[model samples]
Target: MTVNVLVPSSLSREAEDKREATRKLGYVARAATIFRADRLIVYPDRDGETGRFDDGFVSTVLRYAATPPYLRNEAWGMRDELEYVGVLPPLRAVSQTGSESNGSGSTRQGIVTEVGPEGRVRVNCGLQHPISLNTPPSMEVAEGERVTVRISSRRPVRAKLVDGPLPGLSVERTDLSTALGREDAGVCIASSRHGAELTVGRLETLAGRVDRDGMTVAFGAPERGLPEILGIEASDVVAAYDAADVDDRVDVEPTDLGFDLWLNTVPNQGSKVVRTEEALFATLAPLSLQE
Candidate 1:
């Protein structure tokens, strides 16, 4: 008999041991439903068995559901007993393509000849440089240099050229950029209070992942987009329902992200405030899943 095992989802993505282990559990059917298990307000079995698990012997067990933090529901919420998923990716910039024959195709390649803070770049291309052409960087060029550029065509009089300025032929400019170093870098914001502080920075990841725009930050632990990282819901923490309390995600924004966390009940009573710049690492230091 293949008995169905309904594991608590609160620890699914939180505790590392459970995250991987839960993923391995092949659920025949998966979903959350409110039922009666020991009169507990948990996502019990189809029969509302919240605790009584009977394989051979009867025993009591806790059940947690997968409620994302951002989800809004009364009760059915927890502070720290949450499961986690991977971090979300950054948003990509939208762009279009067009060419004389149709599209720029793969016929364009550029080197960063010059650049500025706001993603402005002066590039040298393979548009037949050092020939009867135009260079945008306004720098000196050598003969027979490989360059290509988007030329201005009007009056049916096409001006054919490489890329660099000829002995005397002048060129035009375009706002087109070659490469924007990293949009996920140099973003700075902070939130603080009394003496505790936290700051969120938009920077590059070692794996070359872009998180500038979609990069979430927090002042308090729960603010760093905890609902996104942890599968805890507002409904979980409310006494009207039953759920375990959980911790805040490390990178959450500590402002008014909302929570019944230890902080909210303790040092951070009745406050949805924000401000920061102190030993953030100290507050976030001991929070590792190493144990």
Candidate 2:
């Protein structure tokens, strides 16, 4: 099932400096990657943003964190792709691909350097040098196109082209409505302290829904929660679904941000506040347990 994690562009509002901001964003990326989230979306929160924190900087650091170290230079080679900040850390995620049965070959992403006669093409698959592989007869590849390669062995370099999308954390910048409105977005959940408490039975039901529909979990900024970010009152969000009339439900969602549910993942909290990165880990931990 597809899983999308949403964080506000003002996520680094609490950071003391760019270096600290980069480090904090590293934890966010790490949390997403660890939870196996397909997409990490940064939504607009300009009002809540700090003067020192830059949305572009946040995206740059997140993109770098998502990319594998070996492919960083190639995938983000263009100078315009990212403005160099130099302080972003290498946030490497542990692979979920454990030693399992069936011996399915490992897959690696490669960039097509050149296309030759008889469908032969040169690919740079994070190796010491580029390797030439034949494209599937049905598939027509071109130069500068990204391709997936299935590697059966590394020593002898036995590999083949696998016609599919490249695998990794994808970073994006967009608005909340646009993100939730995507066709791939199934169940949209907004996390908030004022939301409904998530219990065992509730989680199971949500997991089943996630398994069927895919999910988009949205997180708020440090000081400004989603209600504030969306220009609404906390009480309105808490009682959004409490309205008796179906027609009146529109009032609850003024921004037309279609969220299936607003959830309080951490029910009994001792602390007065939860940081954005802390909230990400806390919320995704239970969701990951779902089917």
Candidate 3:
């Protein structure tokens, strides 16, 4: 099943400096990686953005953090947004492609260094040197494109171009409406302090649904909750959940933006405000539990 995590483009508006902003985004990336999220979407929140770090800054740092260490230099090169990237933490996420190895071989993320004749391409898969491999007849690739390579033997580097998604999380930028309307967007949930308080029974039911259909969770930036970002009053969110509780209906429309549920994942939160990165861990932990 697919798990999509969404964060506002103003995610780092509360950071004190670029270093802090980049570091904060690093933890967000770490959260997505830890949860095995298929997509890390940055939805536009232009009105909520502040300071120097805008949507572009947020997306660039997130994309850079998601890149594998072996291919980072070649893939991203240099950019001003990554000036404080060294402060970012490392995300040692495992490669999903190797789950079905079964002794056949291991899969590694590779970058296409060059395209050659006869449908061949030179790929750098973190070996001592780039290797030339014939691209599959059905597949077409270009230089600088990331691909997956299955390595059978490292001694002679016996490997072949494989059709599969790259390891780890991928970053994307889009508007909230488009994200929620995706075909794979099973259950769309908005995280907010003014929403329904999560209970044991509710979690059990939500887990079952998430396991069966998948989930797309959206989070707001610091100092700006979903109610504020979406222009919906906090009272409306509370009333919607209150109404849902009266009747056993899950199809409550708190807002016209198409979110199935507005959830207060951290009920009775001690702090006055929970950072977006912190909320990611608190929220996804329970939702990711499988039976």
Between 2 and 3, whose TM-score is larger? 3
lDDT of 2 at 212: 77
Error of model 1, residue 201, in angstroms: 21
Please, what is the TM-score per model?
A: 0.17, 0.83, 0.92
How does candidate 3 score on lDDT? Answer: 0.86
Q: Positional deviation of 77 in candidate 2, in angstroms?
A: 5.3
Ranking by lDDT: 3, 2, 1
Q: What is the lDDT of residue 194 in candidate 2?
A: 75
Model 1 lDDT tens row, 56-158: 1111112212211111122223333223222211111011123432233222223334444333334344233311334344444433232334434433323
Q: Model 3, 1-291: lDDT tens per residue?
A: 899999999999988899999999999999998988999999999998895899999999999998878788999998999999898888876763234431357777889999999999999987889999999877899999999888888776799998877766889999998999999998788888887888887777677678878999999988889889989888888766665551344333434556778788899889998889999999999989986
Worst 10 residues of 2 by lDDT: 243-252
Full-model lDDT for every candidate: 0.23, 0.77, 0.86
lDDT of 1 at 287: 19
lDDT (C-alpha) at residue 67 in model 2: 71
* Candidate 2 structure quality by residue, lDDT tens digits, 37-76: 9999999888987767767778878887777676667767
Give the least accurate 10-residue stretch of model 1, judged by summed lDDT: 32-41
Sorted on TM-score, best first, the list reads: 3, 2, 1
